[model samples]
Target: MPRRAGAPEVNAGSMADIAFLLLIFFLVTTTIETDAGLDRMLPPIEPPEEDVIIKQKNIFQVLINKNGQLLADDNIIGLKELRVKAMDFLDNNGDGTCTYCKGKKDAESSDNPTKAIISLKNDRETKYGTYITVQNEIVGAYNDLRNREAQRLYGQDFTDMEATYLNPETPSGVRDELKEKVKRIQDLFPQKFSEAETSTSN
Candidate 1:
């Protein structure tokens, strides 16, 4: 009788460890993306006030459809042109009141920055990206004007002021000074914008 040789068995003693290491490696390598929502400051609650009537000429109406089509002041405009149109509408001193304004002085345009209001409306099915783009264009229009004014007055850009004086690292005294400057700029280019309810139509 001859003794038969047996096959070598697989050593699985470290298999559990290997599997755990693989699981950890996958967990470390996997990246999850997060949605960056609109970076806007929420308005504080206030007591009900009387409805102040705003003139139609002062309101710069902007409409967006689900297809991302922009209707600026009842005229179809591309996204790239929205900023210029908004800037013109805001900076236009139709009444020759704003000395800072350098607009075309159209009688039908805004009388002053304070009176210029942007009325933004979108369709219910409008894409979030499109809405954000439109909002950015409007905001950029304001920023461009503010930055130019800041440069003219303070010899610095508005964004530079924010980065230097508004950051957490700024000193308390310096922050107060910056606040005054920012308030001045706000007075010059007040953001009197309003967002209306989504329209039912496309």
Candidate 2:
């Protein structure tokens, strides 16, 4: 007897469906990451009771125009001189307090060391780099004051002193105190360093 011929069968109808289901699954399950933003300290909403308003007199106003020109108390100054003037102002409180030493007044009506307020006003179009430079200078002044205070509290050349016997934990308290003092100084000035927009366009 002769063998009967059989028909070859092929199944191609479900290939597209499998691919579509896989694509949908991947699309539904995948997660995309978002970028984190810059970190900064923001003010609180509610005003606290017994807010002691310290009258700010030693105001050093720094202005930067769109042209990158720097002004201290409305007087034009170069970058080098800006640092010098800022250091001077920080060192000497207009109230006769030596900012560097932070000395207190004696029984007599004498001068006590006080901190000054730095009011920075920049044009609306002022470059961010210029603003950062001014900010760095102010921070540097505070760091210098901190170092001086540390030297006075501890012995001279404290950096070179060994930590063999001294309690390292005690310095943490000192650092906290210094940080509070710096906060006070920073608070003396308005937290909003930039001023309102000027009428003239940059």
Q: Give the winner by lDDT.
A: 1
Badly placed stretches (over 4 Å) of model 1 are 1-6, 25-36, 43-47
**What TM-score number comes out for model 1?**
0.84
Candidate No. with top TM-score: 1
Query: Would you list the clashing residue pairs of candidate 2?
Result: 97-112, 97-113, 98-113
The whole-model lDDT of each prediction reads 0.91, 0.57
lDDT assessment of candidate 1: 0.91
Superposed Cα deviation of residue 156, candidate 1 (Å)? 1.1
lDDT for 102 (candidate 2): 41
Error of 2 at 142 (Å): 1.4
TM-score of each: 0.84, 0.51
lDDT by residue for model 2 (89-181), tens: 555544543544443332222222343556677777878888778777765665555445545655332222322124466577666644544
Model 1, C-alpha of 1: deviation from truth (Å): 6.6
